[model samples]
Target: MKKTIVTVLYLASLIASAQPTGLPAAVHPAEQLAALDGGFWLAREQHQLRQLDGQGQEIGRLAIKSTQLDARGHIAAVVDYGSQQVQLLDARPGQLQRLATLPATHFSVEALCLYRDPQALLHAFLIGEEGQGEQWLLSASPARKVRNLSLPPGVVHCQVDDASRQLLLVEEDFGVWAYPADAERPFQRQAILLKQPYGKLKGGASQVVALPGGVAVLDQAGMALHLVRYVGQSWQYLRSVPQAQERDGIASLAQGILAQGVLAQGVLVRDAHTAQWQLSRWPTKAPTKPDTLPIVLPLAQTDPVAKLGDAADDPAIWINPSNRADSRVLGTNKKQGLLVYDLQGKEQQLLAVGRLNNVDIRQQVKLGTQTLDLAVATHRDDLALVVFNIDSDGVVSELGRIPTGQQDIYGVCLYQPKGGGLEAFVNDKDGRFLHYRLTMQDGKLQGQLLREFRTGSQPEGCVAHDAEGVLFFGEEDKGVWTTSARADAPSQARLILPVGRRLQADVEGMALYHGPRHTYLLVSSQGNDSYVVLDAQAPYRYRGAFRVGINLDRGIDAASETDGLDVTSANLGTGWQEGMLVVQDGHKRLPDGPQNFKYVPWSGIAEALKLD
Candidate 1:
């Protein structure tokens, strides 16, 4: 018998799936124009305070090269270094008056302090510094001369006490010192050390306020708030509040710590007694209820991205309001990459994107005769806007990538003008949103830079309705801000939906949905595995929350935090490719581990979301 030879050939052809028939087929190269960069630039220019109004609508606009609001939020002082003029406006009254003026010089004012009591005529004092550490003080009135004041080294900011007689100087090192307003010499440096001069606090202080009976201080870390009481001779730590700090609206009261904002609602009363100090709201005589823990639905996937150890965040989902029954999701995998999936729990495609910070998608607005689905991917280094064409055959193609400089881009949105051809808005890491227009010419897109807008510090999330001509942006330390593309050349922006809740995690992702019952907003908490569903209409109720938990195949890592989510319900034609919830599974790569990515089905997530 001649030897028997057994050979196995596992040769399977890898063919691209034929474009789904019945839908529009997109033309190649002609549809290639990355709009993400256009979006980022628009966010940057629109980040400023475009207009300010008081109690009602439409008031005279406040325009200045630079302006700073006082601590009380009552007055805004604008001294245009270039114009050599100073103006004061009653922020509440919309009252603009030329308070005083200054000579054109290299020096500029940095802060405005007003007396707590209005009876005092001394409009507090304004402190500023110039070349060679030269310090000058000006009277709130313009007629007053700029008095030279001898100040200590590294005086970054200044504040006044209730009596306006004592000046609180926040040193560059973040140390607090008290100097008499009439003192001739620099501060006699009686520093109020919160932690008894621990090995030099990191980052230094940002804000400091004197609390009732004690001084409340914010650390350089920008994370915790501390209260120090004068224990006879030395400063003693009374208590340190983290989750309930000012950013979250929890303040210290005469009786105890009063927690306000979002953590105070829903529940009748807290656990009453716990290891942590408790503050009771007066139900009968108790305090009012505080916002309770937001409702969350955990996807519960244990894979790397959904694992607790992974530094994941910023999740968005696309859902068809007409048919909530089927939806799809697109999310960023933090440093890992971006993952996409269908509504039936099947992985469609996994692109090797680097450190994808955010993923946003909107219906292809008809630009000329072409309609394209605007898909944007942002990274820490640059903004990539890849337009995908939903061709007549229903096939999606990667058209092109819009590239900005090497900087982090966080938020992205499509602003579809009432007419056609969409303008994309993107929030950059530098705290601004840049706008760009996607023009369809010769069967292709040519991205043209439109303009830029000022926004809050560290803008991380954005949602826009090009058809409505409105744009919404979110900040980590600030609230949700809105701006109109249809507004004047200056572009009007304001805080429309203030985030009353002080979140441990910064608001990173936002999705807008118009439904029969109401509009809905889904926000992602990047620091923790939590998502808040808010009513888009009426009172904007706290609808619920969703997170990544075990039932969703996410392991019991107990440390998973949610980031980036995009919900789409293609079954009902919400402009999504199909029914899928695209979510970014924030998973870290192990030293010698396999790749990282997670995809959850729309039906699978529905079950988890319905857990209540």
Candidate 2:
């Protein structure tokens, strides 16, 4: 490798005596600074911001209580403590334009930092002195959250490492802690160990600066610059370069890249230089391969649910036997009833049956002398199975409700045995599953408990392969399990996929895609906001996993926190010529409406994972 300034990192930390003799006019003092790569800096003092050049010359300034810039300094997130608002600025050189402003918090703010995700969405993370932490999506509306952090008091500094996708926090009296930066991920943090014998911080790090793939820690007590590199999920102490740590009391450490028109591509750390902060640079290896996220966007989305706030739960597709293009989607509005939509995602019918949770459909099923399709959902109010009949014209009407001989009934799926009739599998909150034999007696559909079994934990989502009569169910926090779906079959369940690696916990929903070329079992890996696909036959080869992303052209947001999903192999016109997959959009955004379902053609999934 070619020699760079990184070879002599120790010499780079030395404070040069040369000052900025020819400097820009006066200012209070650089209280906080974020230096950009191209000799630009975001210097904040109280509610005013001063843009500084490499020679410590002020170009422009703005008014903001607290602020931080992104990794490349292309954007800045500012907090107005007085107005309780957070703003985003287009921080590209001279154009510090105010892009958007929204309410941040109602309480007093403590610390703030800016982070950009792999999708190029800007986010602002705010921490309160009373241990309140919020991550706001700054690209559009500023405030939103998945995991709201309960931080410790006095944590005054935080930085988001875009390279490693980790959030670094500085607590002054305690060692630094690193956490997964994505808000969709669960809240988890690990204390980064950086005590290297003589270079250890007496109490904790005085200042920590995030580099491309590493972090530079300044120890005021021990007088050292500790550089730690992030290697595969954890941080490793590389080497601590000795330096005289000085507390100038004028400003905190500001870090940036020195590349454009400069002598080298190195980390630039500025210290107190008379009236302005001087610069010191050190080089390191460039960032590794770009992060290839596992995300899959939907082709179209249905209208937002009528009822707001987590009302939409699961979905089922009713394929029109006469005209496949007219097939309607049956989605459960947990707060209302069932919602039926056509292939174009418009609500066709709304059945005010009851508070329905999950839903499934068995097309062309025998009910008495009629060959009508049946849609069933678990009714929370009745503790029963609410059944619906879909006519050939794709119109859905209430059939009857069969009280499930259980409490708190959850998910339900339909199956037909090779030699026999239709069966429904419904589960309780405590892992109790009951299999019922459906019958159309006296023109009223009813269920008779045939057999039952219980898992170790709560299980909801389940789907049965009609060709094989094998049932697949998700044990939310555990994993997916399979068993025979026959009415007279024993409850001999077999563990298929355990929750780990690719399949995260709370596995919410499952669907089967019976394509001409491939039959795969798709499960909603709700824990990570992604879906897992496996073979339908024995061994169940793990095909791959993907996430439903936002549709920019259509202005539909990504789906997350999915409770239930359903798919069909019948061609549904235009984009869904190869069939379609419908998933519940748990956390709806991009206008922030009630929850809805997203539709993705099988071709998109096949192309994304490189499958047939």
Candidate 3:
């Protein structure tokens, strides 16, 4: 026994020495940046590719509009923005090929990544935005004639999960779409990771990312974040994250954005005042420093969420109107119900949501109680209206359920009647809008349907106000409609995105916020994952559609589908509130399985509205 004990001690020492020490030594210093690879390819706005090392140091420079890197620190393909062409570089010794013209009009290179076949033929998949759908361009040569990869329309971003040997395509509202990369027809639906549609948000066009054990996702509803793992034969929810309340301040880095089982990066802010670009870098267990510092990039346009695909879904803000404060936000998930976020968009709590759909918070409420804000939500399976007391420990309860045949009800609203009573309104899948009288006794909702109106078919949006004595809504196949407090009044619904433009008018969600000059009507469309802002007073003309992505054919061939839409106040940020909108994404499950959650910010929306 003593001999065995001595032998164990000797073996234990060998194991101890084999393990790496948790020390604070610099993995790659500024002077030794070339030692590291596999990081984000950093570049300036002019499309100048600046090879940044792990320590955020420039190791080399390549004047190209866009670039994709290989395992080693070498440029695979470089696009010449001026001439609209591509230049291939030799892998062994980095040298660019003279000239190569790609058979794509206005072909700008983006979403570049490397994928290899089982035979070890390393190929690069590059996606570009041409017309309504994205162009899938694949290349095996560093700069050979770019091959057109025939894929389904609506593919916005893609990734080849080397571990799963499959391609994952994110279609807006359809769910996490997967396809076997090795198959001849590599673009057929394989498996749906998870899908739950909340009113306005589409189940397709969401984002996906790989985790240690399984995959995680930001649901298309823009209300929740989820983590799912394949156990025996089914996908089960390992964890769920809640929704975030829209705020005005910037979130600090100390309080990281939390989702699934890991840390999430927050908004990449470019300090216009100081011309410095600040990126939120979450701490990882691996010994590493930030890839980029808080310095302005070479080009002016710097939207970090641009290339992130669908990971950006939930929107949150710090309460103090600054990036260095503690804060909370409200968000949602497809599997879980509602989620409240802290200052950093971290999951505060995941509420037990039952068929919960779209959620909107009333800001600038001068109510006496500290809980001034009110959250309104639509339901899926039932006509239930989920209402929450907007306080620190706010509790969301069923305010009242509409009794119109438990079909598909999408929109909900809280309005006080001029006569005295408070009213609740809900939209239905079949063409009708039901109005209810909300009777909240001791913080519990007890209600009944007061009246029902024919608002064309598939009423998608609902907005009402007692003070103004006006209610507004819109239909999917129809156009915008409005009514008054007078019961005998005839409802007047107008065709906003009229006839020919009706192709672009699959209205999904709507919100009315008090703009500086006028009340802006924010409308949603699942057809293109876009939104339109209309003038409140007169001439409700077009406000350019907000553009987002749907990577439908990274590896999977998918039927293009878009759904779910919500518009937050531009004042969601400080001062005027940077007008931001969160759209739900559906087809985002990738091979090897990963989290696919997406939310986009329309800082440009605020600018166009002159709010910025």
Candidate 4:
């Protein structure tokens, strides 16, 4: 790679010409400025929050102690360390409306920044003297504490990179430490760049501007900019861009604008002593690898499973024939049992039938003369099929257990014939499957061995498409394969999609959503935390992929590391007119509880992916 240094040349003459460009007057000390949509928001040493236009003109002003703008610029968080209060404001051009005020940390704050979580909630990170750091959920009514963290001493500046999921803290005399932005994840930190004799930095790090997969740090003492590349799990100091002249006090930094001056891209700097600005210009460029686009926000998330780590594994949606609105979701607590949740994500029932891995449901099953809804799960403890009967009123009760001779049972799916025969296919960890015919003989449920199937590798998640008479299996660590579901069909399975760029490995879950013009297959690409969509029928043309983003409006975290998912093309009365897609949430946040399942409306996925 070519070693390129982004050199920012500062001219003192620009200082005298600053006022004409609408730059703030050089009277009060320069403070850190928050980047807004059309301009910037800042709290000067004069004890007031000021907004500046593109030309640096004063567009709005508020009497607040300190202000920090979220990356989206939709909300402004003002912190008054002295009074120990935090204020939230709607950050619009010329309309900085005060929304709410709440008491923040009792410790006197030194540095603070607003971070938006995967669930779209805004949190304020309060950094006090020494390494005292606390995270508070400001978006919650009355505000609540999230977690307490630690940082290297002397962090006068901090920023959250929502894109990279990293919280950057500049240790004035040392370097920059990138902490996991998701507070719920493990507490880990990486030294991104170091200062002085031990490293390449010319001066101590003062401020940082987050780039797509990197950051540009401002070395205050040396009057230079350090660009750092964020590699997987770590960051490296790439190079530096030195300034030509000194303009004093402390400087503020912001990004995301069309660069008109110094470095690379839109890195803007304002001198605290002069209130004058120095701009760094970076060539506007397109992103390299495509990002997880067209995000679909989750509507609701179920209560965390009883088991703590890696418990919630799969989910199956049960549509209510009598009342679609009251449809329930069936999820597996791999460490516990079966969990039944309503559309609102409230746990409606729990059946401690043993460790259940994967789950599936079939509505209107013929149980003698009564048509009932049934849920079938792979009981890992017994390596058998545990059944539950759901009633018209959405009530649930244990039916019976069907034992499979397989050594291990990891995934299960039901194949219900329209003519009234209910069968199930259970997969084991060694890639062996057993198909069983579920029957009622002498008024007792029994299982009769039908046929068998074999795969090349381990399989867990499986979905049966009744319309196509085909069963799709996720060969974990590989990709997907499908075979005929007919009782007498060949046991051979053909690989439809392999592990590749579009379909990431450890393919966790497979789901089928039958639409009016198109039937699609949704696969959980666990390696990348995204879902890949493909044609459900033959060729299985790849449509597109998307990530479940946090719904800031609802405070529901995105789903990740999914194990099993199920979709239904029925009118879910609760406005999921097209249908509903439910998946296991491997990583749960918004206070970091146990794993749960997230409810996503299929219509949102259809619209985002432009599905027919």
Each model's lDDT comes to 0.43, 0.71, 0.42, 0.72
Model 2 reaches what TM-score against the true structure? 0.73
Off by over 4 Å in 2: 1-68, 71-112, 123-158, 163-293, 306-310, 488-490
TM-score of 3: 0.46
Per-residue accuracy of model 1 over 1-612 as CA lDDT, tens digit each? 110000000100111111211101111101010001101000001112222221112233444544333323333344454563444544443343344454443445554444332212233345554311222223232323323455655554555544323455655454666654432212344565423356234545544544323354555544555555534324455554443322311111121101212121111111112212222221111221223332222333323343244445544444434454344344455565555544443444445556666666666467777665556666664456555543332233556667654366776776677666677776776787778787777866667778777664778777775545666667766666566765345677676455554333466667665543445566665544456666554345655555443221222111133445555434533322223444444432111122233343444434444422
Q: Which parts of model 3 have CA positions greater than 4 angstroms off?
A: 1-335, 363-372, 393-405, 416-421, 465-467, 485-488, 502-505, 549-562, 568-576, 587-602, 608-612
All candidates: TM-score: 0.44, 0.73, 0.46, 0.79
| Best candidate (score: lDDT) | 4
Using lDDT as the measure, what is the rank order of every candidate, best first? 4, 2, 1, 3
Summing lDDT over every window of 10 consecutive residues in candidate 4, give the lowest-scoring window.
Answer: 1-10
Q: Model 4, range 226-284, lDDT digits (tens) per residue?
A: 77776765776667666665433222234422233322234445553455655533543
Q: Write down the TM-score for model 1.
A: 0.44
Model 3: which ten-residue window has the lowest total lDDT?
Answer: 1-10
Candidate 3, residues 284-378, lDDT tens digits: the string is 22211211111100101111222232222222222323332333455544334566654323455666655465565553333222324456666
RMSD of each: 30.3, 7.4, 23.6, 6.2
Q: Which ten-residue region of model 2 has the weakest summed lDDT?
A: 1-10
| Residue 164 displacement (Å), model 1 | 40
The better candidate by TM-score, 2 or 3, is 2
